[model samples]
Target: MDEQNKNLILATVLSFVVLMVWFILFPPPEDTGTPTAPTEVVQTQDGITVPAAEEGEAGAPSLSPTVAQSREQALAKSERVEIETEHLTGSLSLTGGRIDDLSFTQYFETLAPDSPMVTQFMPAGTSDAYYALFGWTPAAGSVPFDQLPGPSTPWSVESGEVLTADTPVTLVWDNGNGLVFRRIISIDENYMFTVEQTVENNTGSEVRLAPYGIIARHGEPTDLKGFYILHEGVVMSTDGELAEIDYDDVVDLPVDANERAAVEKKTVVENGWIGFTDHYWMATLVPSPGQAFTAVTKYTQATDTYQTDVRLPVVAVGPGETTSSSTMLFSGPKEWETIRDYQNDLGIEKFVDSIDWGWFFFLTKPIYMALHYLYILFGNMGFAIIGLTFAIKALLFPLAYKSYVSMSRMKKLQPEMEKIKETAGDDRMKMQQEVMALYKREKVNPAAGCLPILLQIPIFFSLYKVIFVTLELRHQPFIGWVHDLSAPDPSSILNLFGLLPWDAPGPGSILAIFSIGVWPVLMGVSMWLQMRLNPAPTDKTQAMIFNWMPWVFMFMLGQFASGLVIYWVANNCITFTQQYLIMRSQGVKPDILGNIRGKTQADSK
Candidate 1:
């Protein structure tokens, strides 16, 4: 309809298209070393599948691939055995470190019990350790497949290592070179398993290295519920006018294993952060703000093969020195305090996704904290909201008083303004000149009435963000019927069949909705009465604009949080009471109260 609206729609369309493309191309790569259905194993002349053992079978392994080879060539003349690198446990094999699913849980119904990623990442489908959000590569560069034989040595694990909380066992593995990698795993009081890994180069020459991590989501993308996912650790508003797709839809990226060539062709990041997202909830692994990190998706194929490609934060490291990284996994309900506590450690609080108040946070945070304390005392967020609103109104009462007094004094001078309008005829500019001169002589500041309204904008926006994103109010209930202030009212119904989109929530026990309808009507009635008491805007267009604000606001804000509606209703009622008291041109009068009572009755009808 307008240039702004058109641009907004275009921007939204472009964003969704990009997000769609990214989603398809960036399938998570998780390699679960288990072979999907072994097509064929090394076979003997007897037609038996050799080399590959059956499930649960134990074997004494030998380094030579041809253990039972024909006794030809006298078994290489029985040469003296020598060790290249002493075999030991190393970094857990990442043959299939791919994320299969992602989830977040707030309820205790799941085993993780209010943790976001309980079922998704636990019970690893392929390996013991999961490396996520990091990318992998051949140590020096791309290794020539022709130059190296696959699996001359297989990564190994020992089950009887006996790892315990008191005495964690060391894991060692040879990296096909003289180098040995070591790591230790231990259980913590919180019932969490923690592992620390270190790479040691026993070889005289420098060894090559590749770094990565693993994460998973258990089900298909859309089937995953309650959990919200963030792309590259960024979440945007997905509702209202802000709804959009982050991946470009016109072009899809190759996520299937067959598209492996596409990955090699594209430049991948070396390090960054990636994780599952829950709305007011957060599951993130953030590096220091200035430090760079890569966005990686580990995709596992049906064959149980997985690989990781960096999407961002690309870097490289050189020999000998250890490059250490930390991954702090959170599987709990989204609590702002808890999230904030870890902001410094992992920057996880950034995932809490609070609306940035910018410079206004200095003023608003204190006010919000005080309101939160009151909520704690009352045990009702709705009451706390009401109390905070009134307190703000009371603090600004003097300013509001000045505004109403100026308006009232202007009402007495309306006849003069009207005379100016009449004499000036249709020359609108000349009429304003006369009105300003009259106001200047009367010692009235025409703009003084606007300061209160200006001050409320930031306050209004800050409260709106806090209400929408604050975990404190996620499932909090109010009196009568409203529960889960963070979610839309379940009782509200929409009849899309009508197509005009005017379907409203039917009258229910919700004080919020009821108060909303009643408050607007009250505000309108108060405005009409105040119009009769105070001078109207000098310009007819300006007066019409002011006159229309309440109705427009009522329609737009009808379904808003009951808490916000209550504040407006209270503020209006208070303003009306104050206006009526001060309008009599003297001390308290019976007529003023009688007029207000009549207006209230008329409005109720």
Candidate 2:
């Protein structure tokens, strides 16, 4: 094979291998038998034992079936302190003083205007019970569990009629002993909530207790995308390092023969946060930046529950003294600006890293930032993406120009190359040597064309990551039939572009392979036209591979987000224009019509 053909094949094979490995490593979840029951009692590193269920409280069975309940039914079970803010609307449950009911006022479950708002936290007693609970755990011998407010403890609103950015709410619960516990909950204009818990001791002696926060989820969310690119499970930033544990990984942790559950804990001596992250929303517990804390992630086999906890240092409350500890709760969309603000302004370490930037974080972060700024400038995400693509192309224009110039030179030397091949016939080594010498004399680099193509791979992947994972792209509109740029093109050729009433195949289905969309088809055509800028390869195998590659890519990427498809199509068209103009400027006109006719004749022959 020629050098150029070899380069092409190598790049194609490498790209294919990378994609295959990714798909293999993160296959879709498979159906499994019911999970076994968790043990009755689960112990943490802090020596606190949590029971699977309180007496007479309805709990999930050992092999319980997946059940769902209405949001109203779940909220009606507990008295709640109403939560209202510019960006959030929910309530704080009186039982356990958990910030359990939360919905983002700005986001919805679907693109439809009437669709329900996105609810991030759900109170217990519901099928998908998830919430954040904060309280104190007495030292080993200091006080019993009943002495402190437990999960079912009822707290009364002592101050503030409603929880808002300006008006904070305080819940007070007297332990019916010498100790009284008060929690002051305050929210910002965004999603951050500051929870301060204070304990006043009136007894004669001192009491030692450890303050902790727990975020518990009864089971995996039914709406989980389960895509490998996005994380939908435990995410923690401890000290300076970040760790992510998927739901399956947590459930598959090694269990002792005597233990009914598995738990993993890490001690962070400085800054850290722990929580659960959905595709676009996250609820994390952020402790004070300079304090030492023990972070734990656990999965109970019996209850089928996933929990993350941060246990802070033990505090001693002396008689007639008051002790207070505060924690920040983040529950809302993972907007880059908002998260970065928390990281920078709130002093949360690596808080912005929670967005799951994947392997190409360096490129993805900047790409997303540029897209965000352009969106702000243009007031349209679709235009922002197009502008970003144009900017990237401009930035790489030097290399692209050099590549096209070299390609034009190579085309000009085609006659000389043919003469050398004929003179050195039947001697492969001699022909290669002559070709090399000729290239040197002509100052043409055979590898130049590969540079632009090579550079595009990383940019393409980073753009895909940005579009697929960012909340800003969700429900964003472009043009006709493209209400959601983050989703696949809704106009499928199979349906005659909406002329037919039938819908395209659902994602990941077997028939989805053939469910090509309009943007993908356009991308394929652009790629084909770019390839036509040069004559068909003389080698039959090379020509055949080149001919089929674009269609294959079209189908392979058919289900990708429309925004990414648009970028690819735009890139191809720009590349074609550059190559055509450069070739013409070099006084060598490309015979695209002749090339097409020649290929058709070869096929007929």
Q: Candidates' lDDT values, in order?
A: 0.41, 0.79
Q: List the candidate 1 regions with Cα displacement exceeding 4 Å.
A: 1-105, 108-138, 141-195, 200-206, 214-278, 287-325, 330-334, 344-371, 415-433, 488-534, 538-545, 574-605
TM-score of candidate 1 on Cα atoms, chains taken together: 0.55
> Compared with the true structure, what per-residue lDDT tens digits does model 2 show for residues 464-519?
99999999999999988889999888888778887898887776666776787889
Give stretches of model 2 more than 4 Å off.
1-27, 30-69, 254-260, 415-434, 508-510, 596-605
lDDT value, candidate 2, whole model: 0.79
Poorest 10 consecutive residues by lDDT, candidate 2: 52-61
Which one wins on TM-score?
Answer: 2
> Looking at candidate 1, what is the lDDT of residue 252?
29
lDDT of 1 by residue, 198-232 (tens): 45544455434443333433222222222123221
lDDT of 1 at 165: 35
